[model samples]
Target: MNQSFPKAEKLKSKKHIERLFAEGKSISKFPLRLVYLKTGLPEETRIQAAVSASKRNFKKAVDRNRIKRLLREAYRLNKYRITEETDASYAFMILYLGREIPEYEKIDHKMKQLLALFLEKETGKKI
Candidate 1:
């Protein structure tokens, strides 16, 4: 797996983001919520993703940025779980649900579990 989050795979469209929140399905694991929408994507793109940390929870810009970074890193490393097995393309937003700063280990573990839950729910098969 490339494991690098390239610009091509980053979710940047305002319209798409709105549609995603309106129509997307979600899987939640504490401190993380995976909101995913089934949709057409550019060729060779299985998923385009974005990460967010709520400003209300983390008032400091530094804290929010760090949380977003961790979310993105966790997703970037483990995204192969969704990319390899499924044919349909998706738009994904991984939201940080915690009020406090999170450790990398905790985020990584929850990310793996969350992705596994997503795969099972969408693919109808055990991982």
Candidate 2:
């Protein structure tokens, strides 16, 4: 209900991150790919997310950080699409796969698509 990306919403635990990569289901939407797994965390912390921009593609840290900022902003704004009342919690790692920097509009559109796709898969209910 806060609608803010606080520390609780960030996917930061080492064990969770490792488990997500090892056992998560993945989906790609152009520049963004999401790896997500259901977690044992409580409903209040239902969804925890991490964003990554590949170091190999973005040689400069600034560039990578900028891309990650965009990704996080987009997800922050649109997370409600996938945040329904449910018993399951999810951990998500969003990987940026673009060769070039992307604009906010493009990232926003794709983020919506990604969330919608995730919801569809999760509930077999279309939004």
Candidate 3:
């Protein structure tokens, strides 16, 4: 599979996002929190993802943007772990919950663990 995160893999629909927030299950690994919901979609496009940073934590747009960027990059690099056989597609929103700026290595490490946990939670089977 391609490593790039294309637009088709993005969670942009307002209705879908609202449903995700309303009904999704969440798992947090320190600085990162993932809210995810599963629905029926094509196999090739089984996952749609979004990243968020709270305005209350980071007052400046630049700060929020930076955190989101890092979160997206980490997820992009490690998202392949989510490619298990399943009957439903997943929509995910990753929230950065750090009080201060974090290193990319830290985020990457945590993101890998987070993705594994997500797979386990969603599938009810170990990956």
Candidate 4:
């Protein structure tokens, strides 16, 4: 499977981000929270995602950046499981709600669980 997160798949539009938070539905798995919105995207990609680390939790820019990187990596590896069957496009914002640094293994596992939860709730199908 092609498991790459290209620039086209990153959520960067300010207008879209505003609309998403204003109108999106969210699911949480402890330190991770996923906010999703169903919308029409011009790109051919089925989903576009963005990750955030709370500045309140991690004071330094480096720490927040590292967490965002880890979150993105985990999503890139696991997104294929969700994208395979869905025909409609969506926007996703993954937020890290932890107060401290995290291990990659924990992040990866939580990411899988989070994605499973998203799939279950959105499509009524277990992954």
- The whole-model lDDT of each prediction reads 0.93, 0.90, 0.88, 0.93
Stretches off by above 4 angstroms in model 1 are none
Candidate 4 local distance difference test against the native: 0.93
Clashes of 3: 0
What tens digits encode model 1's per-residue C-alpha lDDT throughout 5-121? 899899999999999999999999998999999999976887999999999999999999998898899999999988887999999999999989999999999999999999999
Clashing pairs in 3: none
What are the TM-scores, per candidate, against the unseen true structure?
0.97, 0.95, 0.92, 0.97
For candidate 4, the per-residue lDDT at 34 reads: 97
Worst 10 residues of 3 by lDDT: 80-89
Count residue pairs with overlapping backbones in model 2.
Answer: 0
Per-residue CA lDDT of model 4 for 16-101, tens digit only, reads 99999999999999899999999897757889999999888899999999999999999999999888857779999999999989
Q: TM-score: which is higher, 1 or 2?
A: 1
Comparison by TM-score, 3 against 4, better one: 4
Q: Residues 1-127, candidate 2, lDDT per residue (tens digit)?
A: 4568999999999999999999999998998999999988876788999999999999999999999999999999998777763457899999999999999999999998988888888888787
Ranking by lDDT: 4, 1, 2, 3
Query: How well is each residue in 12-38 modelled by candidate 3, as lDDT tens digits?
Result: 999999999999999999999999988
Candidate 3 Cα deviation (angstroms), residue 108: 0.4
